[model samples]
Target: MSGADQHIHIEWRGGTCRVKWWSGEYLDNGRKRYESKGGFTDEEVAFNHGRDKLYEIRHGTHVKNRDGATPMSDWLDDWLAAMDHGHLTERGYRSTVENHIRPYFKKQNASVADIDVLAYRAFKKHINAKMKKASSAANIMMVLGMVLDDAVPRLIKTSPVERTRRRGKFVKKPKERKKDMTPQAVEQLACNARTVFGQAGYVFIWTMAMTGMRPAELFGLTREYCYPNWPLSDPRPDDEETERYEEDVERYGRGDNLMPAIRVERQVQYADSTLQFFPPKYESCRSLVVPDFLAELLKDLLASHDHKWVFPALKGGSLGAVNFDYKYWRDVADGADERSGPRTRGARPAIPPVPSFKGRRLYLLRHGHKAWLDEDGHSKFATESRMGHEVPGVEGVYSSVTVPMERAIMKTLQERWDRLRGGSSGSDA
Candidate 1:
């Protein structure tokens, strides 16, 4: 071997051929780095292996030994630490790693390079077997894919996880639209909530149904964020928000002409066994307009409570996310009976189950609010903005919620409430 052939060296050792090839990488000491393989009976086989390795190096698809040696757990830790995520998102990622990823890979003692297509498929099988919910399994797989993707070109040449689009007849069926609570059903739920949690609960149910604010946003609502106070109580706007703030100030100063609104800037998050205030998911901070009826309801509720939070726990202070459903919400939505433990003397009557809300999560109220907005034929920009969702593309950039849209929303919502109330009164007659 001579000239260009010198880049690859083949020698016979104990009647078997060994091959070494320059990796095209240089050491700090001005020396050429080389990689090798052994135990080939034929010299041509060893030479071909060396040629393929050299090709990979030149194409930048080679995974160095030192980089590939990193353990999956260690790599996951580094990947998670480098991610820019909100507190809740970070917590969720950590949970997925600790609860699913670590346990499965721990037995294999897998390294960064050990996970190939077969290994990833095996892991997916294991995840499916362990997780009851398909959604949970999918989420874990997504996190694992992301972690591996971040390691590309460094720890591994490419991620083993492959995402294929469902094509033709294999495409997923459109999801069934979620059921929305009717105005009368919402009223029934609120009355039930009032029985279970007093006036605060009554107002809480109504607020969620009317505004579509997320459960966390409602949980974290402070006195200053509620009607008649927000926007005014908020700190002075930064430079970019100056114009909007001026417009809001002008509108607010218009006495009875003002359409009530709440600012959704923060949410209550539970972490490390303590409740903390964090920005709403995706930091979708926006002002939500409310009907006059809801404004009066909020005013009365605010006057009733001296706590910092607009809606405080029965025992006082911020509401706890843990066991909240088991303790209070289940009774409110599912209803309580003799089996719900002995009723204390002077306790409110057993809550009758709202049929529509049965077996449903509290978050559905927000969904129902969106449904109501759609039913009333509100503008897409106004409805999406109200729901804390950004409309995509050029439309979102150019369109915005104007005063007329806000006023229209408020009027429709107020009318819905009044109609429900009038029906209830007529039934009493």
Candidate 2:
């Protein structure tokens, strides 16, 4: 018999026949390959199953079956460790794998080949049972899909979790547009944050609301890159802090007509309880122009503190995400923790709501900034550039943000500030 025919065998286990076979294909590293599949009532079906494994080897769509027998829990762990992830993203991925993916698959012993559309459907069902929000389930699925897609042809033939409508219905919920915080709500959140987190909190929230900066980008801002005065040069250290800032000076310089701007180049993240910094997401390094009102406020902040970070924690360290959320943001957004003490009365003054803000994230302020730009009627190109998103198609080629464009944006923002804050202009800061 040929080598492939010699390797095929049949065995009865648990009142059913199992097909055992050699794939006749060595791994790239020259390791032997084998496969096992059961649940056939007759030897003929078992033989056909063994032949199917040989057929797959003739086609290059699959590799040796070493990883095929490995449990999904172990495979997912290996997959997560093998892929490149930034500190923050790695944290999130690990959480999903540990908290959600592993538990659901704990009883599953089926290898990569055994995992199929039915398995994914069951996983989705588990997710739906556990999660109340469709968005949360969707997020978990996204990460799972990424893992499976990367495992193609090596650990599995193809990703079992397909996005297509298999049975005349879409599997996932239709994408929903996130609601934006209103102008009034944005103003209130900033003011309340100031009261709760002090001046640093005010500057942090206001800057994000006006600038549309990612939270990491906000945490990443430094004194050197903060340009409070429009079209005017700020004092630069003798040594360049970042090469990107130096390149910006060489390429764009301080044009006489340019508006006040902040340099957004890096982002702060946490890994293993330690702080890490890297280029902003997608390397979306850009200068964000500040309105005149915000410029003055930033200048005041810059003058008040000569630290390395523009928005450091009250203590002498970079802000932590957990610390920022629970200590400051949650209290302000959801109202001061319901004041519980032995001497306290039954009820306290009702905490006023900030429209769509209760139980929502501080990032909503950033999303609201985009809505503001859209309402102001800025060109899509300018809006996308300012938001650090790449504008698509030919419009991106022909469209460049001009002096007039900058002025219009600044004027619109200034008008909003004046109208909302009742012409107070925030006390020269």
Candidate 3:
């Protein structure tokens, strides 16, 4: 990734001294170093400077950043902080350890080039000690490689890890998730809903099963973006185009009779305790086609709620902490049997305590919807768009494009759901 940096720049403020500028690597934050050759008066000078610095930084032969070298733990700590700024979700932070990063190299003091091959090779053996799934191990390897790869330009540290780490068939890929709502779990949770926090949480879970959007996308949803009724739906509301949304929604499904299929354009996030607006996760925004049942649900969800959001309110509109802490939600799900909805009519059975973690992420709905589509033989373009895989370069190219359709994709998914419900493909629910 390097061979792109050069050490030279100019100051734009004072053209006479404009030639005086920043270049090369600077040791940063006690032991870590960052690629430093940018602030230049001329664009070419800055580009050339950073470009060469990346080469030296990644290759690990650079003179400027020798002091930044440290144990793997220190570098990873810095990496975690840096990733906090970039990730749209906490997956980056949580999976790093749970997926087997700490077990092997947590103690090693890694230089740029050395950490790539040998340490990782040892990690592979270490991972096999605990991880039974090949795909899971592969995922850990991928995260390690990506972190090292990022060091290429800024740290100019040589990473033995390559972008692609396909090492034989031992590294099996993870099975794609197809089950959005298992019948037992859904029934148990629905039964528990009425007795606790009312119909709201159940409806939220139902919304996930019915519509294949993510939790953030659901939370960011507003009445203006969703409702087609008078007042709230009125465009150009109070002038100044307070409508940061609906530009594209109107562009596609415009006017009074607009059938707004939820399109994720932006999200409200609480970072540094500040409410910030940014584009949706997976980078590219998409529009999903909801079933007619889900459409009715959305209409009710919009009309019934006084809250600004479709889901229940939490002060700042971010659910980062609430996601992991499912005790409150678990209590609701576990106690739902005694509650009354349409069918229960009260005097329901006593339900058991269930793990709330699985129910927490609304994105599980995406997997369920994709499975149904795959069974129904939907197009690949439709599937990819729904998943929102718009990242660039390697992952983007692989993800955005639809691979050849598999024959078993439908049969397997449908059969699994059927088995869960104690029914066959031809049997009625």
Note each model's CA RMSD in angstroms. Answer: 3.0, 6.1, 13.4
Off by over 4 Å in 1: 1-4, 165-180, 237-240, 320-322, 338-346, 424-429
Tens digit of lDDT per residue, candidate 2, span 1-429? 666677789999889988888766577888866678889999988897787778777776655656666778778878887968766677788899889988777667656667789998888898988999988999899888887887787788878987954777567857545565555766677677766645777778789989999988888777767865322353443365567446556433555655678877789887667777787887787788788888878878878776677877766366654467877678667766445467854434334456467777878777889999999999888899999998778998888887678778889988888887774433211
* lDDT tens per residue, model 3, 124-239: 67776767887777767777776676666445446667455566678665664433445455545544543443455555555554446666666576655553332235444336
Better candidate by TM-score, 1 or 2 = 1
RMSD of 2: 6.1
Error of 2 at 58 (Å): 1.8
Strongest candidate by lDDT: 1
Candidate 3: residue 233 Cα off by (Å): 4.0
In order of appearance, the predictions have TM-scores of: 0.91, 0.74, 0.52
Best model per TM-score? 1
Question: lDDT, candidate 2, residue 37?
Answer: 82
* Selected candidate, larger lDDT, 1 vs 3: 1
Instruction: Give every collision pair in model 2.
Output: 297-429
Model 3 has a clash total of 26
Sort every candidate by lDDT, greatest first.
1, 2, 3
